[model samples]
Target: MAKKSSVFICGNCTYQTSQWIGKCPECEEWNTFEEQLQGKTPTSNHLAIKQLEKERPKLLDEIDINQEIRTSTGINEFDRVLGGGLVKGSLILVGGEPGIGKSTLLTKVLGNLSQRDVENRVLYISGEESTSQIASRMRRLGIENNQNMFIYHEKDLENIFAEIKIIKPKFLVVDSIQTTLSPELQSAPGTISQVREVTFEIMNLSKNQGITSFIIGHITKEGAIAGPKILEHMVDTVIYFEGDQNGYYRLLRGIKNRFGDSNEVGIFEMTGAGLMEVSNPSEYFLDDHENEGHGRCTTCILEGTRPLFVEIQALVVENKFGNSRRTTQGFDNNRLSMLIAVIEKYFGISLSFFDVYVNVAGGMKLLSRESDLCIIAAVLSSYFNKSLDSRTVWIGEVGLTGEVRSTPRMDIRLRSIQQLSYKKIITSKKNLESKEILVNNLAVNNISELKNIFD
Candidate 1:
C-alpha cells in the first residue's frame, strides 16, 4: 500500500517543515511556502546498483583517449562557451531572464546542427510553446523546415521519454524542465519537487541513452536557476545568457562545466537574423573614441584564456540632495562606494559633495578587479575636468592604502594593448621590464604616482 503525508516546502530553498509557515527561514522569503502531499518513496532506487554490461576498471595508460569526442554545433560562439563543443551524453542547463534569447540561441544551434548532416536527427520538445509557435520562430530565423529537425509540444515526462526511446535522436532539447512533470507527483509544475524529479529523469535518460541534451530553465527573481541548488549539481554544464534585454549585446557565461573550463565567456549580438557572434568584442565596446580621455579609459582583463579590452566611463556632478548618490551600471555598487572612500582618504579628494556615476560600455558586467585603475582614473579625470591621452590604457588593481597591485597575466594584457596600437600603458612596476616593448609602458607603485602622471 502507498502512504501519503502532508508537508510544507519552500519554493525558493526547498526547506521542509511539518506545518505551513508565512516565511521561509532559510531563504528569508515570505509567502514562498506551499503545502503539498508527499508520496511514499519508490522501492526501486534509481541511483542504486544497476544491472548492465560490466567492464573491469583499467589503469591510467590502458584506456584509449580517442574514444571520447565532441560534436560541433557549427556555431562558433556557442561552441566557445561549451569549451570547444558538446560532449555526447552531456546534460547542459541554460538559464536566464525572461526574453533573454535562451530559446532563440538554442533554436539557431538546432538549425545549424541539422544542416550539418541530413542523417543526424535532433528533437526539440517544448513544453511551454506549441509546434506552430516554434515553426513561426524558425521561419523568422530563416531556418528551413527540414526532415532531420523535429519539434513536439509535450509536458508529460513519460510521453517525452517514450518518444526519445522510439526516435533515438542524436541530440535533444527540452524547452523547460519546470513545465514537465511526472504523473505520480501531485505537485504542480514549476514546484521544487516536480522540477527536481523531472531533471533527474532527463539526466538519467541522457546518460543511459547517450543523448546530448540541452534543458532550458527559468530563473528566479534573483537571477538564479529557479529550483533547488542541487539542480545545478546534476547537470554536466550550466551556462547563462546575460546582458541588457533591450540592448543588442548578450554574454554567454559558463558557471559549471564538467568537460571544459568554467571561467570562459562568449559574446554575441542579437539581431533580426538571430544571434550573431562578436568576433572582435574589444572593437565593438570601444567603437566611440571622439571624447576618449575626459571621463573614459580602457582596460584589459582575462576572460578565461582570452584577454578582452573594455571601456570604462565615469561622470561626477554636484549633489542636489543631502546624501550624495552613487550609481553604477555593469559594476558592483558596493565596490564603487569603497573605491570612492579610498580616493577620498588617500588623495584628499572630497567626492562627498558630488554625485558619481560609473558605466561599463556595451552593457557587459565585469567580474575582474583589474579594472580598478581605469575606473579610478576615469573618476578623477571627470572630477578635475582633465583630458587624458586617448591612446593610453590602464591595467591594475587598487588597494585601500592607495597602492597599485599587479594583475594576473600581465604579458598577455600588455601584448593585447600593443596590438591595439595603444601609445602608452599604465601598470605596476613589480615584475615587468618594458625596455624592449614598442609601446611606452609607465610603471607606478601607488595611486599617487598614477595621479601625478595625469597632473
Candidate 2:
C-alpha cells in the first residue's frame, strides 16, 4: 500500500499545511496546528462559481450612483453610531463576548423596524434560541409577532435559504453564525471550519438576494472572533459589543464598515426594562463630587465624530514602597506615566515618590490628548487641595512646556457642551478665538485665562 499524504491545519487561522509544523507560518500562532482529514487533493471550491455568477458588468459612466439614503431607527444614539441609518443591501456582522447582549440588541432593532407601518417584511432567524424563546423575548420587547415580522428557529443552511426565498424579507438577521451548520461540511458547529463555511454561505445569500443580513458571531478567549480572518473580510460591516459584565453600560463600536466611518460608536446603559440609549454621556461621565472637594476635573475626549466631557480624578499620596505605585482605570497607564513625567519636567511638580492613580469616571474610555490638561490639573488639585468649579468643562492638550494646545473639531465639542445647558467651557485660545470663527455665549480661553477665571 502507498503511503497516504496528510494535511495539517492551523486551528487558529484555518491555514492548511502539507506536513506538520510547530508554528503556523500564516498566522504565526504556535502549537495551534492540528491534523484534519488527510486529503490526496484540495477540496473543491463551491464559492468560486457563486462569486462569478454574482458579478454584474457595468461601466463607470453608465452606472448610476445616487447619494445614500439612511433609514433611521428613530433611536438617535443608534442612528448616530450607524452614521445616520441602515444602508440598503448592507451586510452587517455583530460579534462579541458571550452573554454581552448581542442578541438583545439585534432583537430590539427588528422589533422597532417591524412596528413601522411599511410593506417591507423582516426575518429573525435564530440558531441559538428556540422559536418560543424568541416569542417570549418579543413580548418583553413590547412587540407582537405580526405579518411584518417572521420568526424562525433553524441551524441548517439549506432550509434557511429555502425560507429566505419563500419569504423574501427586506431585512434578515442570523442570530448566530457559530451555531449554524452546513450539510456539505461534516464539521461541528462553532468550529473554525464550520463558522467560516456558514458565514460565507450567508454572505452569498445577502449579496445575491439583495437582503441586508446581520450575522452574529462569538469571540474566543483572546477576544478575537472565532474562525479565520477571512470571515471578517467577507462582511460589509463589523461591529462589536464591548463592556465589562459587572458594569452597567454597553459600548457598541464599529470596527469596520464599507458604507460609513469605522470609528463611530454607541453607548447604552443596561436598565431593568432593557438597554437604554445614553443620549448625553457627559451626564454619566461627570460625577456629583463636583461640590465636594479637589482631585477631580472635567475634560473632553473626542470619540469618532462625537465630543464628550469625562471626569478625570487622581489621588497622589506619599509612596510607602519608595518606587511609587502608579495605576489607572479607563485611562491608559503608559500614557499616564509619560504625562506625569512631562508635568514634573515642565512645571517642577515632584511626583517621583508619590503614589498616583488616575480614573475616568463612569468607566468610559479616554483615548485622545484632550484629557492631558485635565489630568494634570486634577493631579495638581489633589496635591493643592483646590476644588474645581462644578459648571466648568475643560478641554485642551497639555504640551511638554506647560503650554495648553488645541485639539481637532473644537466647534463640535463646544456645541455639544452648549446644547447640554452647560454655562462654562475652557479651551485653547488659538482654536476657538480665531477672528474668522463665530459662536454664541462662548467664553474662557487658554490655560492662563482659565486659571484667572477660576479665581
lDDT of each: 0.85, 0.76
Best by TM-score: 1
TM-score of every candidate: 0.92, 0.87
Tell me the number of clashing residue pairs for each predicted model: 0, 0
For residues 1-455, what per-residue lDDT tens digits would candidate 1 score against the true structure? 75677898887678999998898889998877877788754333332113224458899999877755888888887888899998998999999998989999999888888888887789999999999999999889888858888999999887887787678788999999889887758787887888888888788777877889999999988888988778999999999998888899999999999999897899999898889999998888887764646788888888877788888999999986759999999899999998999889878779888999999988878888999989999999899888877688888889888888888768777778778899988888872654356788888888887667557
Which residue runs of candidate 1 sit more than 4 Å off their true CA positions? 1-4, 11-13, 21-32, 42-67, 320-322, 431-436
In candidate 2, what are the lDDT values of residues 1-455, reduced to their tens digit? 96655567677778888788998888898877766544332143454224335457899999898998777766677776677788887788898998788878888888787778566689999988999998888778777747788999999887887788788887899988888987776556776667777787777667777777889888888888877777889898888888888888988888888887786888898876677898777777775745666788887677778777778889988986789988999888988898788767755569899999998888887777888878877887787777876566777787665577877887787777677666666667765775333333333343444443334
Reference-based lDDT, residue 443, model 1 = 86
